[model samples]
Target: MSGHSKWNNIKRKKEKTDGQKAKIFTKIGRELAMAVREGGSGDPAVNSRLKDAIAKAKANNVPNDNIDRIIKKASGEGNSDAYEAIQYEGYGPSGVAVIVETLTDNRNRTAGDLRHYFDKFGGNLGTTGCVSFMFQKKGVIVIEAEGLDEDEVMEAALEAGASDFQSDGDVFEIFTEPEDFSAIRDELAGKYTFVSADVEQVPDTYTAITDPDLIVKMGRLLEMLEDNDDVQSVWHNWENADDAE
Candidate 1:
């Protein structure tokens, strides 16, 4: 499995915890709000961003009532939280390349929090393109593997314009060009259940922390970053990502 798929599998297990699920819902809700404000409409039919956000929220198993409420609030007047997307690139312990993406109303607070997490956890933040050059943005759709044949899923996904497909024991992962993700996911959704569907930063290279001490610090860094409400996503090619299972 690629880095993106592996990290997603880890998160899937974590979602079983109510606290973690609540955090996931909060993150998705923020994305939904941002989509509505930026896309200028709550109707997913006309707003591509909102449409994608709704699909992701559904894939994450968020309740429809919550989704409806978020959409209504986002589309109404006086929803004044204006979040701007910001990305921070840095290196974690053992020189693991890390990227933290955020939707923040206050840039300074988000940046400072991210910097502190990196510095206090044995890493250093860098300029905009420092580690981003090693990552690619792609659309990833994950489906539970239960009762599904890998070959069958591969064939259908290929026909629907997926760039790649893999069955990673617990889940079937489909990759697509960012532009094709929504269309392909919509096609697959008709016949299969999804674990998740989102556009994500995928790493081209992985950094392994062989030293046990570095691993501990790296893990803590990831936890702190993920716990931040402003942080939307964190991408890193940590070799032991599957260890989270």
Candidate 2:
């Protein structure tokens, strides 16, 4: 499996743990708020960010009523606080580069929490742009390949302007430029059922960390960062250990 796919699978497993679902909900809520604030419209048809947020919320089983209420509240002047999107760069265990994307009402609180997590996990949060250069922003869509032919899927994705395509087990992952995300997704709407689609910072190269102890520490640090209400996504360059079972 590719490093990106492996990390995604690990994230899926982590989300199944107790209390993590609530964190996921908070992140989605923040995303929805930001989308509404930026797009100036709550209608998904005119706001791609809002559309992606709603899709993610629905995928997570967030209730329709709650979604509508949030959108309504955001559209009006109802307690909708503007959130600033911040990106923090750092190094995790084994000197692996990591980038954290967060939407926060207070930058101080978010920065403090992030720095503490990195320090506690034997890593150091660096200045902005320190580690981001090692990665590229791309839109990734993962779909179930249970009954679909890999070749056919590849053809469609390529025709839709995908940069790369790969399969691991029964899942097919499609990568495209950030600008081409919506078009590619629309093109494949009726052709494939996607497991998930989101924009991510993909690492150009991976740092291999084989020690089990350090791997556990890195995982804990990542989990803590992800659980923060302000944190939207975390990207790292650590490769899955070959001995991981």
Candidate 3:
């Protein structure tokens, strides 16, 4: 499995904790709002971003009524002006390149908070494009592999334009070019139960941070960013397995 996948599994394992679930809901809600605003419609059939957002919400077990209410409000143009997508680049502990994706109403507040968090956690936020060059944006889809054959899935995914396929436990992850995401997703829609699907910047190479203290500091920084309402996702090049027990 990729280091990204491993770190995700660790986070997922932690989601059962009460405090973490609240943070997860906040992040998902922000994503839904941003998606609805950007797509300009709440109808999933016509809005690709909204469709993905709904899928993610369902995956996280977000309340159906809450999801519907958000869509209704978004469609009616009440909160559309309050959200904007922003990207931030930086270096985490041990010089691990990091990229943060956020949807915020107040850019200044988000920027200041992010910088403060980085400084507090032994990292520094850099200007745009400073660390992004070390990564490539790609679409990743994770599906339960209970009823599917790994080899068959791999073959199908490759034929459907997937760039890579990996099995982590009973989960199968399919990666594709950003443009090919919807095509691959549509092809496998009914064949598997998709756990989560999203576009992310995958680091081209990892910075192996073997020091335990540095790893703890980096993880703390990532958690802090993830907890922020404006922050949607955080990506970095640090390989945690080298230091994580």
For all the candidates, what are their Cα RMSDs to the real structure? 1.9, 2.3, 2.4
User: What TM-score, over all chains together, does every model reach?
Assistant: 0.93, 0.91, 0.89
- Candidate 3, residues 1-245, lDDT tens digits: the string is 13554546545544568777777787788778777878888899999988888877887888999899878877784464477889999998889898999888899999999999999988899999999998888888887778889998889889888999988776788999988887788787767777767777888988877777888888778768877878888888887633543
Candidate 2 lDDT over residue span 114-165, tens digit each: 9999999989999989988988888888888888899999999999999999
Best lDDT among the predictions, by candidate number: 1
lDDT agreement of model 3 with the native? 0.80
* Cα lDDT for residue 213, candidate 2: 88
lDDT of 2: 0.82
Candidates by TM-score, descending order: 1, 2, 3
In model 3, the Cα lDDT at residue 2 comes to: 33
Give lDDT tens digits, candidate 1, residues 49-150.
999999888877889999999999999999887889999999998888888889999999999999999999899999899999998999988888889889
- TM-score pick, better of 2 and 3: 2
In model 2, the runs with Cα more than 4 Å from the true position are 5-18, 241-245
Error of 2 at 192 (Å): 1.6
